[model samples]
Target: MEPFALTVALPIFGLIALFCLPSRIANRRAKLVRNLVTTVVGVECLFALSLTVGLAVKGVPSQSIKLIEVWRDLGLNLDVFVDGAASLMLMLVSFVGFVVSRFSIRFLDGERLQGRYFRWLGFTIGAVSLMVVAGNLLLFFLAWVATSFGLHQLLLHYRHRAAAHRAAWTKFAISRFGDALLIGALALTYYAFGTFELTELFSRARDLATSASQVTASHVAIGWLLVLGAVTKSAQFPFHTWLPDTMETPTPVSALMHAGIVNAGGYLIIRMSPLVALAPTAMISLAVIGAFTACFAGVVMMTQTSVKRSLAYSTIAQMGFMMLQCGCGAFSAAMLHILAHSLYKAHAFLGSGSVVSQALATTGAKSPQPSPHLSLAYLLGAAAISAFAYAAVSSAFDVNVVTKPGGVILALVVCLALTTWGWRLLSVGEITTMLLGMTGISGLCLAYTASYLAVSHWLQATTPLFAIPPTPRFVLLAIALAFCALFWLHFVVIRRVRPNWLNSLRVHAANGFYIDTVYRRLLTPLARS
Candidate 1:
């Protein structure tokens, strides 16, 4: 069988079995349901794994298979496009789906709604796989909508809970609005190019680039529309409240939503790199919003008391960071972020129930803060060591550093981390131990940078390298500097300062700067009416 068909078929068959099987059968033969779903998803993961391995060994094949001929003259068809990006996404979704399915087998063992949960889970996984591999705008859009509805079923699993219902409704509303923007973007793309085929659209884009018309307002509008849809889907800024509130759903659903589904926004942006990069306004908007959202979400995350809610805010921050990478034309870096975050967040959400116990276990071993007088020396040591590490890693890995703002900023972040680590080691006041610790930290930093560069290079096949616009790139650098400065200030104030004014500041930060409250007051009336 063809790879694309197999990719879509395995999951669909599982979903069909899930939907067709009787509820009575599921309840009475719960083991059967578990085995059947697990086996199906396991096989699907194997298929994706094989596809990924094949692609890795043989390189990406630029071929698509059309299953239906909608209109011969207009280039309309039901097509499954296979490429590095599609394969990577399919592998990620299927692998996560399989893991989640296995987990649910044990997690939801005796629940009355086990069958219903797996049913929607299977459908959602299948639909998202289809969306990732979709060859045209129509198929992608249709699958996108289907995935949304299917996920809604999962999100609202506890329909009796008011919070679950509210969160699901909020998600539904935002999803619908995003769906509309995607449709509009699709319509505009069709209007501009006269077809929805991905390859053909990109080919035409290349052609238009060299022409006198270069890029028109319609193309720019499409880019903005696409960004809006992505922002909403990924829960950036104001569209983000629903995600945290969505903690009312089951833990497994939270894992899936954060790890795999929410990543679609970044995927969309990266997938459309050829087009989005052409629209300066769209790029700027993505960067600005992404920067703000990252900062806002990170601050909010710090103040979150609940484990799940904190995880939710962390997701928001990570998603914003991913979007920022895309906006900076660091598509490959963004893809790396997506892949890494998906795996990490999946583990985080799945294991969140253990957080309280873990905290209790570690409560007695907290490290003491270093003296404030050492801050200046620590800062200097961090700067020097980080610079040396950057040069060493860049040379050893042969990763291009100076050419891209993303690479530069990433190196800076590595330096920041190392600097903090070095500061703590130096605070010990033992020269021999400090020297040994510094050597170990340096080696670790080298390994991390080298490994990251290697993975990013491998993923470059799927994600096109992007060039940042000067203005937005400057804005990104400014944000990075501001973040670093604020981080240092936060540490200094918390450790050294005894000012009473900061009490109110801490309160505001804890309340998310009252942004969500303001939003509720303003939007509640609209929601009621």
Candidate 2:
């Protein structure tokens, strides 16, 4: 088998091996099960690393291999495809799997269902790995559903806890709804293109793009269906009630769900960017919805008192931002976001307990309150410095921030983030601190620009270069203004200004605007039946 083929096959086989472990061995030899699962995951990680290195050296654009012919007539075949996006996702999932498995061994020690936990964990990881590398829509759909089911089991590890059961059931319901949407999208895709194979579909889509052929209603439907599916899976607003409520699950399960599973929605959009971009309406919808979710979740995250709940909302906000990047046709940035967010969320989830303990141990200090004049000056200075730094780094890297898709807005977003950091640092009122903070911000800007350039290069072959949307300048200006307002509001809240309306808003934000309550009320009758 080719190296790429072997890498894809390993996960499926590992999943089988895990399920085939005897009940007696699993129940009695927990340590052995732990070692076996860890070793398998570790080896998978190594394979992913080697695959990435190999691809880099050879510069192979993309490769598709049929692993099994389940039913040719029905377009149901097991296939594996590798490209920049797949390779990146594979490496991320494998590394996170290995780490989480190792962590679980210690965390779940002496638990009665330790062996069962390892089995499901391995299955979930394998399923996700396979999903990322799937070559055909059918294979991808199967793996997607399999991952959900496997995770469902893992979420129910504490079967006796009613809250765990409720969360799991809620997730299951949402996932099934997503599955339906995906199925509709896949069917429409086959109807329009007459192929489930990704390579052929992409080729045909590109042909449509290059030709004067108008997009049909089926194409538009496929795009809408896909966006709906992705939003549900990624816990976008109105369907995100399950995530924060899932704190009853084991920590490892939470880690995997946030770090790996939640990213599936963004991955789907990136993988199918060629087709999805055909519908401007869909793309615009994604941007609007994603922007709303991010803003909504960001505010809610700030008001969360529980550490885990806070992280849960943070994941929602990050996923929303990622989706927004995709909707803006910034596929490369979206992919980069996935990779960075995955690593950060994994660590955040795994170390959440330690984080809470440390927070309690440390005494909180009031932030220094500089005079209003000095504060305004510092803010303005930070904004200027951030913009200059970003522009310089982008120019150094030979990147045209203005011409790229969603370039201007994303660049400004980065600048805004840096400005916030700088402003906070400057407020510290120490020369040494200001110098160090500026240095750190400079390094971060350089690193971010470099990473974005590299990701764009890697995805050049696989992803389509989307044309800038209509009224790009207008869109950029509007978004920039909105972000500035948000930043101002953040400071106002922090300083406890306008306690009357602000307190009311905080209550609404903390309750997620009662969206989840409405969902539960609507579903109560059906759930009872």
Candidate 3:
């Protein structure tokens, strides 16, 4: 067996082995179970890391290894695909599993269900690891469903809590809907291409792109189905209610779901970029939905009083942004976003207790607010500095901010964010502070451009870089203007510029525009049944 293949297979065999331990015995010897879990996860993490490092050094192209042939006629087989994306995801999931396992050991020290928790946790991790390396749509779909089942068990660990049950059921329902969409996509893929293997499917897609063959209706249907499936799993718009309500689960579970499982949606789109990019209408729909979800959740995140709930909304917003990146054909940026957001959210959730304590410690104190009286000239200057910094860094990395798909819009967002930060410092009215802020902004832009380029290079072999359907100039302008308006609102809110309309808007935003309430009402009859 190839080293990469062995590394990918180890976690699936080792972690799933935990399920073989008798429940009665496991509960009796909880400490032993914990030790076993830690050791297995730690070793798996090391192996995954080495595989990724080796891939990076050798710059291996994507390859698929067949492990078993279940049914040749149906194109059903067990296979593992090795590529930069899979290697990176394997390392990420394994490392996160190991950390969470260690954290759970002390966190659930006296819990009655500690052994069961570890068992399900390992199962969930194994399922995710398998999904990451699955070479065919059939195997990927199986692993996807398995992951949800494992997570369902983990969520119900606190069976005594009514809220926990409600959240878990809601999630199960949504996941099933996503599963249906994926099933539709799978059928359409087979109908259109006559193959379940990813490598062959991608090859066909590339051929169609380069040839004069017109994309058929099945291709469009598959694209839309995939978009629907991804949105549901990632908790976009109305489907995101369950995530924030899931605080009843343990912190480790929450961390795993937010940091790892939630990322599956983005990964799906990135993995199938060649196919998804074929249907411009589907891509447009994805971009619109993603942008709306990001803006909506970002507003709601500010009104949340609970730290965990805040983080949950933050995850939704981040996921939305990542989806937007995918819809824009920036698969590498989306991949980078997943990696960064996962690490950050995991740290945020695991350290939430300390965060709450620190917040309470400084409850009575108020931090300095940006001055509302700053001149418009100063704001313009800040924007100029931000744009200049981004352009300079992007040029150094040989990135075309104008012609690249969604490049201009993404650059605009980055500039807006940096401008806001610089504007705040400028409002402080300190020359030294303004200079330091500009320097920090430049450094951040440099790092952001460099990281994006590196990820793009790494994933170049796996992801397709076809010409994206051109977004209309008017549409791009509208998006830019909307972001600008949002920036102005954020500025006003932070400056304490309270008005009756602003207050009214805040109330609505705080309740997430009551979207979740409507969903609950609709689902109430079914739940009662």
Candidate 4:
């Protein structure tokens, strides 16, 4: 079998088999079910790994293989496009699917919906896998719809739960809106370029961008439509409330959704980088909305009492950050962020049960505050260390990817990381332990930066570096500074009791700034009346 067909078809066949098995058979043969899922997903992961490794060794091959042809005159075909970004996403989906499937073997043991759960789980994985590899817009849309339908089933697994049903419906509503935008985008692409193939569209897009005067209304409309779809898919701003409510779903489903499905927006933006680079208006909109959502969700995350809810908000903020990277024309950084966030969020969701115990352990523990002079020293130390580390890593890796918004935003994140470590060390009473912790944190940060840069370098083909516009540059910097300030404030609010004014803000934050209330109020009356 061809590599693409093998990778895409295996999971699909697995899904079919899972669906065919009767619930009683799956329940009675639980071990067999576990083995089947593990083997199928594990093989998919291996196939993805092989493809990725081949890319590294072969130096970014332009490999496209058609799986099937759906139309002749329209030029629509089910083709697989294998690039660094696609490879990374495939590996991520497969590995996460395998891990979540294995985990669910025990996590959801004896649940009545075990067979049904596996069926949807398998279907979602297969659908997502196909979506990432799609070479034609038609196939991409089909896979996209499949994932949405499968996810809705998974979200409403507990059919009797009102909250779950409500959350599912909200998600479904948002998804349809996004789908409409995507369909419009596809239609525009076909109208403009006369083909649904990515390679053809990208070639024409390059020509259009080069002849800046040739760019037209359709180009701008298509770009905005794609971004709008991505914004809804990633759950930014107004669409974000549904994500937090989705905690009513199963843990594995939450992991898959947050870790894999939610990253679809970033993936879409990156995959269409050629076209996105041409639309300054769309990019600016992405930056503005993404920045606000990141800050908003970050603040709200701090006030969330429930661990799962906090994680949900955290995903929103991370997705916003990813979108911000895209807006900055930091597609490579966005890809890295997607990969890192997926792994981190998956682990966080799967192990969320231990959060209560961890919280209990830290309940009465007092953190030591440094004197003014000492605090100043720590802050200076953190800034110096972070700057030095960033410079060294960038220089060593030859990552001259220091473009406007992405570079500054990345620096802010580094500053936050080092400063948080500095605070932690200040609370440590032992000098030796503090020094050791500082050294360890610095080293880990260096390693992470280097690895990210290396991956960014490899994925450069899929995401060509682009520069942000002048006005958006200033706006992005402001957003970056706001996030840094918000980060510091979050640290403060979490460690101390809030005052009266701050308590009001906390209530607002806890209620997600009343956005959901407004949504319900506006929609509910229309439904009833």
Best by lDDT: 3
Q: What are the runs in model 3 whose C-alpha is more than 4 Å off?
A: 17-22, 359-371, 375-378, 525-529
For model 4, residues 414-486, the per-residue Cα lDDT tens digits are 6676767766665455788667756766686677777777777778667643343543557866887887788
Clashing residue pair totals per candidate (backbone < 3 A): 0, 0, 0, 0
**Residue-by-residue lDDT tens digits, candidate 1, 1-529:** 3654556555654564465666666667777667777777778778877877776677665557787899989788988777767777888988888899888888998889787777778778878877888888888888888888888988888888877776777778889999999999988998988999988876776566555366888888888998999999999987887888887788988999999999999989977777776676787778778878887887778667889999998999889988877887777678778888999999999999998899898777545666566767766775687678668867877777767646666566667667767766766667896787678767976776665665565566444334435444577678688668656754555455646766666678777776666556555554443
lDDT of 3 by residue, 172-260 (tens): 88999999999999999999999999999888887777653578889889989999999999999879998998899999999999999
Model 4: CA > 4 A from native: 1-8, 13-34, 359-367, 371-373, 400-405, 465-471, 494-497, 522-529
Model 2 misplacement above 4 A: 16-25, 360-367, 465-478, 496-498, 524-529
Candidate numbers sorted by lDDT from highest down: 3, 2, 4, 1
The local distance difference test score of model 1 is 0.77
lDDT of each: 0.77, 0.85, 0.85, 0.80
Against the true structure, candidate 3 reaches a TM-score of 0.95
Better of 3 and 4 by TM-score: 3
Q: TM-score of every model?
A: 0.90, 0.95, 0.95, 0.92
Per-residue error for 321 in candidate 1, Å, reads: 0.7
Give the Å error, residue 31, model 2. Answer: 2.3
For 46-155, candidate 2 gives per-residue lDDT tens digits of 88888888889899888888778888787767788988888889999989999999999889999988988888888889899989989999888988999999889898
lDDT of 3 at 418: 95
Q: How many angstroms is residue 181 displaced in model 3 relative to the true structure, after the best TM-score fit? A: 0.6
User: RMSD in Å for candidate 3, one decimal?
Assistant: 2.0
